[model samples]
Target: MKGEPRLAELIASLSLATDLGLGLPQEHVLRQTVIAMRLAEAAGLDHAAQADTFYVSLLAWVGCIADSHELSRWFGDDRQIRADSYQVDKVGLPMMRLMLTHVGADAPPLRRITTIGRFLTGGFRDAVDGFVAHCQTTGDVADRLGMNARVKVALSQAFERWDGKGVPGTAGGEQIEAVMRVVQIADDAEVFCSTGGPDAAGVMLRSRRGSEFDPALVATCLAHSERIFSGLHEVDAWSLVIEACPDLDRPVRLAELDQMLEIFADYADLKSPWYLGHSRAVSALADAAAVEMSCSAADRALVRRAGLVHRLGATGVSTSIWNKPGRLSAAEQERVRQVPYFTERILSRQPTLAGIGSIAGMAFERSDGTGYPRGLRAAAIPVPARILAAAAAYQDLAEERPTRPALPFPQRRAALLADVDAGRLDAAAARAVLAAAGHAVGRRTRLVAGLTAREAEVLELLVRGLANKQIAARLSVTPRTVATHIEHVFTKTGVSTRGAAAMFALRHGLVDAGGTSAERPM
Candidate 1:
């Protein structure tokens, strides 16, 4: 066992994806934690309050991904929508303006009109009130992570208002946790300050003081602006956040780690309806091929997890690109290229999760170096990466995408081999993945004993114990033809018995070695 992962590393990894989900720059959430914890200290919070604030800051948008499919449906790009969100309060006018601008964006004229109609009727209502769902989802992640009840409760209350104007409309003022107020204020401050200066962050905080924020907590944060923001400009966001985690040193149970990763896989798949089962499918194929290729147990685990999370950066890009039916614009393609690099960067931020990032980042790279994010070529990519890439490619061809239908088995095999022959995929790795995907590769396609192609086909069925009548049916030939071919097969092989013919077929590699035997010749 590699022992359990630290609580801090786990949270740091999840928060990296959460940052992308919010459409904020990487480390946005981590930086918020830094600011929030500092605000907690400056406000003279006790140890318990500081701890509560830490959990809330890292997990505030933990459920932000729950409504990604919905966001992408109404607005084209969920990430862009989230980024624009921080610019305006989700109140009357600014919210309506944003909604009006994006209702069925990029859709055809008729589709746009229909989408607008749905929005006016009841769709907009479901969206505006999704806060309760987000809260509950985040709370679920917290509970699965074995967090305390206080952390779960604070998370669910995240969208509530101080004056009772927020979602759920149930909690107000002190009904929401005091620590949550500090974290919420610091969250926006980090985003607002990045574009504006500390002065701008402070101004933004003051603007929302009473109704959206706690007046006292905001006042304390403003009072200690110098100390709170001190050295922040010099520190690395991820390192500072990980180091500051009060629970960073404790190791999580192995089973807990697996469940957490499964949750992340499910979350990644939710980014678009097109991606519904992609991460899990890729993970399963990669894991199986890793075992076939004899990766070390640790590397096997890492490869599987990396496959699950290799698309973490996908959330950073707009779903508009993902859902586009036509060709992408040059600028849009560039955004797509950044996904693997983004995944690598996010995973690298966590000290313990860094190795997995290196492996996951190469999932899209090709042997010919024509792949995106980083055009790693040939041996420049590791074996595990090659396997992951091949596994992902196999699943990609076999699965349907918005832009194309799923390739049939024959086409899938041909596509894979073509990539290998073109020097764009690792030949051995592709073979392993293809075989694992149930696309058998037959090694003996030659005419053994002068058997014709038709005869070879008949011989295979005979060896498998098919009766002459069944063989005739399978080959779509008369029983006389089947019997005549069977006699030719016996005379050519110098064998009269089915058992002897079966032995010959088995000896000639008629059965599966790895891939499906109905495989195309390489």
Candidate 2:
């Protein structure tokens, strides 16, 4: 793991995404990480140990999205529910009160009934299970990335409280890790500061001192409250926080990048159970489809990258809408539409990720003028965007949603083709997506260049908007191998720019069409 991308950098980027998902200002998570690191240093931890603390703080809520489906199921708006989590201690009166207030608070009569029924049927058990799962899942990802065992253990116990009333209910001073304790306080403090300023943040921390937070840390935070938060409001939070990164000397290698992306993608997917593994599946299917479509190597690569993260916006929607068992109300639908836009908002902040953002931002846009957020018709959308959009839509349709069963292969293909015929999806792009999905068209066999199944997997991720590093992790290969695959793909596809390569895939039937089918032969 030594030449890998500093865990801090990836964590920082992830924090930014988490902020967007929560509808907060960028770097909210990063700032908390910074504060946590400083607190760790202040607590006399060594540099190597501080690195562990850094990651733990940034990733404390990595599993926050995991239970979003459940949260939305009970509360309606998952993000709002999470945001409110910051306001209440997850114990006793505060916790119970918050739950009662938020449950079905803004839902319609029908939704309210459903929510009540779910709670009685098993929502309480489900919520607790979801929280425990989030901790374990996040800890597992940290372990997969080669993080310190102690950190992983701490992440697993992140929801534990000193009073033994948290998720796992294993209370004790020793049960809570030193880093987790500091980071927890820091995380809550940062949220309060961002929303209500230093005074409010201070008051919140003071109020929860012995119950939700450590008393000693609370005393320290209150003592230096002004100094800790001074000028925080004036800072360009993203830069201020990221620039303060605990300066590791090496850049992230491709393999490390892949691991981080996979972890983050999984975390993002947790926002709704319906979306679990959706990004990874889309990336794989899209890459195969790209190769089948004869897309240039660069475009195939970009499509893969886009596919890995296309649903970043889904986090912003309330779990209520996402998990509803029936059609969305007009307002709920509108909120759902804003998800793609939110994905772009988060991605736009990082220059390295801008390309992926651009493609993902158009996930909901239709070929015809009927799509939402910004209903740009055909020709108005970029070709790369068109391909990515088609893959995402087809993938979503093929999956079982709360309101609908999974579409059968024939029905799905017909529906997809209807979009093409209606001018809502580019015919060539739709064909490529279908091919990638393992569907056959009249007399046309899917195509693939000199690429292994693994290499094609890598190629599709690239097109979906993952970086070289991200591709390596998802495919379980070395960064160098991912780069080599990219180079080979470029040579075979005859294109250089990512956008151009993506266009080529759409035109050639290389993307997977969201059903079970034999992948193209290497």
Model 2 / residue 226 / CA error / Å = 2.2
lDDT by residue for model 2 (1-522), tens: 443344555566666667765656667777787678667766676776676777787777766665565566577677776777777877776776787677887778888777777675786676677677567556655665667777787787788876667878776565688888888888888888887898898899888888788888778877777666777767676665566665442466653454456555555665654555577777776777778778888677777777777777777677666667777889888888887787777667665566767877776788788886789887888766778777877888887666777788788789989898888888888888898777534433355766566656665566444567766777778999988888887787665433334333433444433322222111
lDDT of 1 by residue, 296-329 (tens): 9877887787788778788777766776777999
| Full-model lDDT for every candidate | 0.75, 0.69
Please report, as a residue range, the 10-residue window in candidate 1 with the lowest summed lDDT: 513-522
Candidate 2, backbone clash total: 54
Q: In model 1, which residue pairs have backbone atoms overlapping below 3 Å?
A: 439-516, 440-515, 440-516, 441-515
Candidate 2's displacement at residue 517, Å, is: 16
TM-score of 2: 0.76
Local lDDT at 91 for model 1: 61
